[model samples]
Target: MEERLPGADRLPVGRRPSEGLRLPAPDRALSSRTGYTRGTWLAVADHLLDSLGPWFTPSGAQVRLPGRGSWSGADCDGLEGYARSFLLAAFRIAATEGDDRLVERYTRGLIAGAAGEWPRLTPCSQQMVEAAAIAVGLHESRAWLWDRLDGPDQQKVVDWLSGFVGSKTWDNNWRLFQVVGEQFLASVGAPYSQDDIDSGLDRIEDWYVGDGWYTDGDGQNFDHYIGWAMHLYPGLWTRMAGTAADERLTVYGDRLRRFLEDAVHLVGADGAPVHQGRSLCYRMAAAAPYWMGMLLDASPLTPGQTRRLCSGMLRHFVDHGVPDERGLLSLGWHHHFLPVTQSYSGPGSPYWASKGFLGLLLPAEHPVWTDREEALPIDEDDQVRAMPAPGFLLQGTRHDGIVRLLNHGSDHAAPGEGEPPADHHYDRLAYSSRTGPELTADRIDNHVALVGPDGTSQRGRIRRIAVDGRRAASWWKVGASRIEVASVVLGRVEVRCVLVDGPGGVTIRHGGYAIADQQRPEATTAGTWAQTVRTDRLTSVVVGLHGYDEAGVRLGLDTNAFGPHSATPYLVRREHPGGPVLLVSAVVLSGDTVWPEALAEAIEVEVDGLRCVIRMAGGPEEAEEVVMDGGGTPAAAGETS
Candidate 1:
């Protein structure tokens, strides 16, 4: 008995009562873990498409969904609604052989849009972004939608799409839009610039730093875009080009295979993607590359593992009330937490998650659908992996089903003078599957800064020094002061060491993970340790192992995507006698109860001049030692348990 948007009952085609998404019953036989079958995917697609019935304009050229418009304004937002949803509808129609109602609905929109109902595409405009989605939809549903259009309407469509020819785009992933759109034009015998397409493809080569990693554009800008946009578009472009793409296909495929090898370790046992990076409002779109892997047969993961990973991701959001009661994807994470969205995130922007539905393109008999679900890396045992390309250290614990990312690189900073201020999403020292960085005033979660008269120093432009096994190191500047940080991850804890080379009397602050929930989290500070525990028993703890003199918790309201109430544990060194001072802290986030004093007791720290050594005692295993020099460079003497 969900409420429908205006004009829902007036639709002439596949309209149904608005009861939210009507998913199929769990098919445990096929999907033993997530219970999401191909039928489940189809049902969700139809439900999403049908829910849009009330939003379309009379001419069907635009879909004006109810929500705040993006900075691009309402005109671009309307086109976004139509084009993004059209992509979803196209996926459904193509997979089902032909959904007559869907084909007709989107076809009408296309014709009306081609007849000038939609806005003209312009250089570096949001319209150019939607044009790529429209081009892909038309290419995928050519037989039913594109081919059936009258010759005049087809010409009009070509004229509209031709805007991509010789047009400039932002140097990032937007380049791929022109590549795909012009390639689609070429497929239809329309005018296209091979140079435009080739240049876009070639531009990404400059950003690819091997190990299957691409920097989005430049300057260590790594995030989910690496999966959803960077890899997804090239794979789809190759599919659209067919035999002509064979050479590039092999190259892109190899890179994708290597990327997936590292990506498989990023997801938690509960299927949550590590909450890092920007544009996170596109929730499950992180799975697009995994689906692309299956599409191009370019993945090292087995069919069972691939399905498990994708299904787990989709179900993770669905279970968390992603679509809400209205069956609409909002510009937020689990709920309407706007901090997770960017200025370009309109109501329909989340539908770019449609790319995740790429799996539906495979035949029903494909092993990805038929194979039984398998466990992810986190479901088996604890894992610690280093991705040097992005300078990330991934640590996953099997007991708690949590995955933590110790980020030594990927700050989203451009390479030049006057870099933009540090963003909470990219500048945090750590991110995890279960916790989000605090975004409220005086943000402190997973950060280290020197509090000065001007303000807290920003961790500007991370310069990575090393990312080796179980350890990573990086250095950044706080005005004239130089700050070096190294992390050694073990089990559920990360030993963070910092070296400060600044003037004296300024306080140094270090923060732990931010835990959030519906209710105010339980927080405590005693002696040299601080802790915050959510209602669900998710815990965050920080202990002052050295240099820090005080510990406390920072409270936030509506500043996190995971919940409305959040708390972060932090330690502060008061009146630091700072020139080249060394500080050490143990940071932990887990589902189990942790005693900060006991944890501090278990970890023994010894410092002689600038060189520091840390030995962490394991319950049943031997102690692990990490040695660090003056610059906070860590060399582990033993393996992580």
Candidate 2:
């Protein structure tokens, strides 16, 4: 049954509730739908809040997740977590027209947190993160909670938050932490350093790479932080600034508007965002930009479309056990898969996903709730969008609703750096909405490696050459070897051709999707010609079109971080002596709705030295010719960078 927004259109925007006015209750039945309405989102928020009952202390200061992981190991982690999650609860209550029960519960905690009734956070820099969350929550609920606080209590809140005034923060997204807290302090007529706020905002401008994208910190670290933190705070800061908004506010709005165009495409038709980047634990936080855009009226999506995107993402996690049976979120992607966490992750980190509830602050009378839900970009049709700023080629297949990201840019390492530690998250050749980074020990899947003469493999830092339409090219070097690759994608099929000129006997290993061993993954091998692995729900296959020799395909148990087992279908070709050697192959991945078997009949390849012709099965019968340029003369073994 379709969810209808009852009486929401009749309500006025930003209607204030009288003393005893009751808010609309969330419909439980909506939770079961594959797609979501506003009520479904609220239901999830409420479910998250209720789960805290067992963990929440009587004073509302500490929420202890005894079984979960912790970072910082400070005594205040409990308090920090409670405050962060309470912020989400506060937004939901305020947005839902003041839910008395939830509001009272969260307001008590807010007052306690701001008043320092709980254990204080360690004086370390990491405290800035939790402080920012507290400030944002308080700012969002100002009318409902902050205004209700007595003068002394309000002063205490200021005094507590003042800890961030001159605190040192990391150069990356951490700058926004200070920016938001100080901005909130200024909004309340609290003493705040204009210089500090200006500095925080200024640094963000330096990180901007245009086309509405900002690398998280520096060195090609672009990830979801662009949405959750970078874009989110600026939009919220603008609202807090109001008519006092400066030129930067207009700039922020413009950037957000431009960003939504690409951000919306990052989400799969099934609601999963691109599973690339650190901190996969913050599941639905990806939806924050969608809500932030809607709140500022600065997004390209319609109000209905905004809700659809946010709701879809939230439902995606909820259905996948984001908040497990105990209603507690773990430090993992879907379930408690810990490999997805960064060093900074703690039990409460998942609460950051609460930022998605920023939409709850939007009144029901708003078009976002009243308008009929609209489909996302992928829901409409198959899409392939090239994001130059992040060096990502986003391809979404309408048939399976899976979005795949072909990475040529982001590596989390700085340029000019030789071979940095391989961060499986950013270093992977590709990321997908339906799959995760192969966080196993070797972390070799979805990457092309140059196996050294010493038997060790090295992956190079990628420099994006160009992104045109459905194709992208990149150049990178490992030791004395320089490699160039170009990718052309069609539906779930990607045709990648690599040219390498390295050491005398360097072999190239190109691995396809690291498909999880879900539902008893079985493999079918066609020797050196092609290889495939199929689970009941999905299929991953790689075929050698034009390569030197040899194919290496294997099922790797416990090789995936997301699932216990996975298999990587790969094609290995030994490099010919001295000159440039080219490896051409086709990789296909499809869900239950699409049969990858069709790609075998659809693909045709012809190779001529450095040039190759690729004709996708059902095309115009015309083959596209690709020329390869091998990096200058190969260096000897000891010629290191």
- Best-fitting candidate, scored by lDDT: 1
After the best TM-score superposition of candidate 2, give how far the Cα of residue 294 lies from its true spot, in angstroms: 1.2
Best model number under TM-score: 1
Please report how far candidate 1 places residue 9 from its true position, in Å: 30
Instruction: Tell me each candidate's TM-score.
Output: 0.94, 0.89
lDDT of 1 at 46: 82
Give per-residue CA lDDT, model 2, range 140-251, as digits (tens): 7777777777888788778878877877788888888888888899999999888888898889988899999998876788889899899988787777777766688789
* Model 2: lDDT of residue 297: 76
Candidate 2 regions with alpha-carbon error over 4 angstroms: 1-35, 107-124, 415-418, 452-456, 529-534, 574-578, 592-601, 632-641
After superposition on all C-alphas, the RMSD of every candidate to the true structure, in Å, is 5.6, 6.6
Residue 449, candidate 2: alpha-carbon lDDT? 77
Task: Write candidate 1's Cα lDDT for 1-641 as tens digits.
Answer: 22222223432233333356667777778788788888877877887888888999988888888887799888788889999999889889888789899888888888888788878878999989999999999988888888888889899999999999999999999999999999999999999999999999999999999999999997779999999989999999998999989999999999999999999988887678999999888888888899899999999998889998988888777767656657788888877667788888898898898988889888889999999988887888989999999999999999888999999998897776444576888999999999988885576899898887877877877877789988898877777787888898878889888888878878888999999887899999997799999876899999999888999999998898887889999999888785788889999999999999899999888866666777778732544444444444432222110
**What is the TM-score (0 to 1) of candidate 1?**
0.94
